[model samples]
Target: MRIFLYSLFLLFSIVSHADGERVNIASFSQNDINSWQTKIFSGETHYAFSTMDGRTALHANSTASASGLFRKVSIELSQTPILHWSWKVDNVLTGADERTRAGDDYPARVYVVFSGGAAFWRTRAISYVWSSKQAVNSHWRNPFTANSQMVAVQSGSERVGQWVDERRDVLADYRRIFGKEPGKLDAVAIMTDTDNTGASASAWYGDIWFGAK
Candidate 1:
């Protein structure tokens, strides 16, 4: 009987491990923003906790501003490779060409950064953006830097004012975008900016998490 019980325990452990684990990056529902830091480029984009769709979320309002909230956390891509999040935009920008620096603005974007450490120039990033003009699933190099790439996860005004859930295989995206294996993920950031186009934008972000496939 003892041996049988031990075997049953082992089987349960294996099954639980196979189910994988989740790492929470943001818990806006619980009003948690303890570890996030703000980085401003042009001007500050106002961020606040607000109730939306019967749940709490982070709301960003940008008017000719460039700013983002970032959290530094090391994530092992081999373990938790999938990123999950939900967002909603009030409207997509008008007359903004995402392919040029002069029009590099987004109403909503969630990005992952891989640190280059001492060699800062080697740092790379992948931004999943809600584009105004680009087609969904299309990707391009950021006009500001080749080190960063942009993927249009959501596009256009067709889905405006509605919450959209997104999931991405970060490991696969990194391999495809950089043509190489990625190291540990250094940080995650979210931004809603219209500084370049000198326009205004608003967005709401739900909780974000990383999980194993």
Candidate 2:
């Protein structure tokens, strides 16, 4: 078996307020990457800040590499279940099949990780991705790990280089996909990678937050 070492760095905490109305995950408006830590998987994906239409956003450039920025967070689905964010991809990866491990590369994705405590085997995650070929609104088990599922929120070159906003009811999606209730969300992460296809990709990420319906 191939040993994969996953490194996790805690940059900051994103906690819901007592009223539990909303939780801010990343402060992109402040052009800050300080509260986000980098984790290298294959090589490295350059992450920084750039201005788009006068608004600051996180930019990522990858050349056959895999890495990401993540933040430890605690969000209650019972209170705030909706997740909101925006992203833009310069181009879609060619000849990439999201169902196969060798084709497991994306231009942009945001995911949530859940911990299973002592039963670490039960840990699972849901990733929202911009797919290269998969149809929009489609989902499948990650080719590398069954515990992590991927959902194609955006697909093709239809929206390339265009900023698109997205909102999802994470609690509902999790229940539908996992067929069970989920524990507190352990973390939230963003990634743009092209290691599998050996292609280059660039993307931009806007402010991310969670809120009540």
What's each prediction's clash count? 0, 0
Candidate 2 TM-score to native: 0.92
Query: TM-score for all predictions?
Result: 0.90, 0.92
Q: Once superposed on the true structure, which residue ranges of model 2 sit more than 4 Å away at CA? A: 1-19
Please estimate how well model 2 matches the true structure, expressed as its whole-model Cα lDDT: 0.82
Clash pairs (backbone) in predicted model 1: none
Where model 1 places Cα greater than 4 Å from the true spot, the runs are 1-20
TM-score, cand. 1: 0.90
Name the lDDT value of residue 189 in candidate 1: 83
Report the error of model 2 at residue 121, Å: 1.2
Error of 1 at 154 (Å): 0.1
Writing each residue's lDDT as its tens digit, candidate 1 over 81-175 gives: 99999999998987868889888899999988877665656778888999998988889988877888899999899999998889999999999
Candidate 2 pairs with clashing backbones:
none
| Best model per lDDT | 1
List lDDT for all candidates, in order: 0.83, 0.82
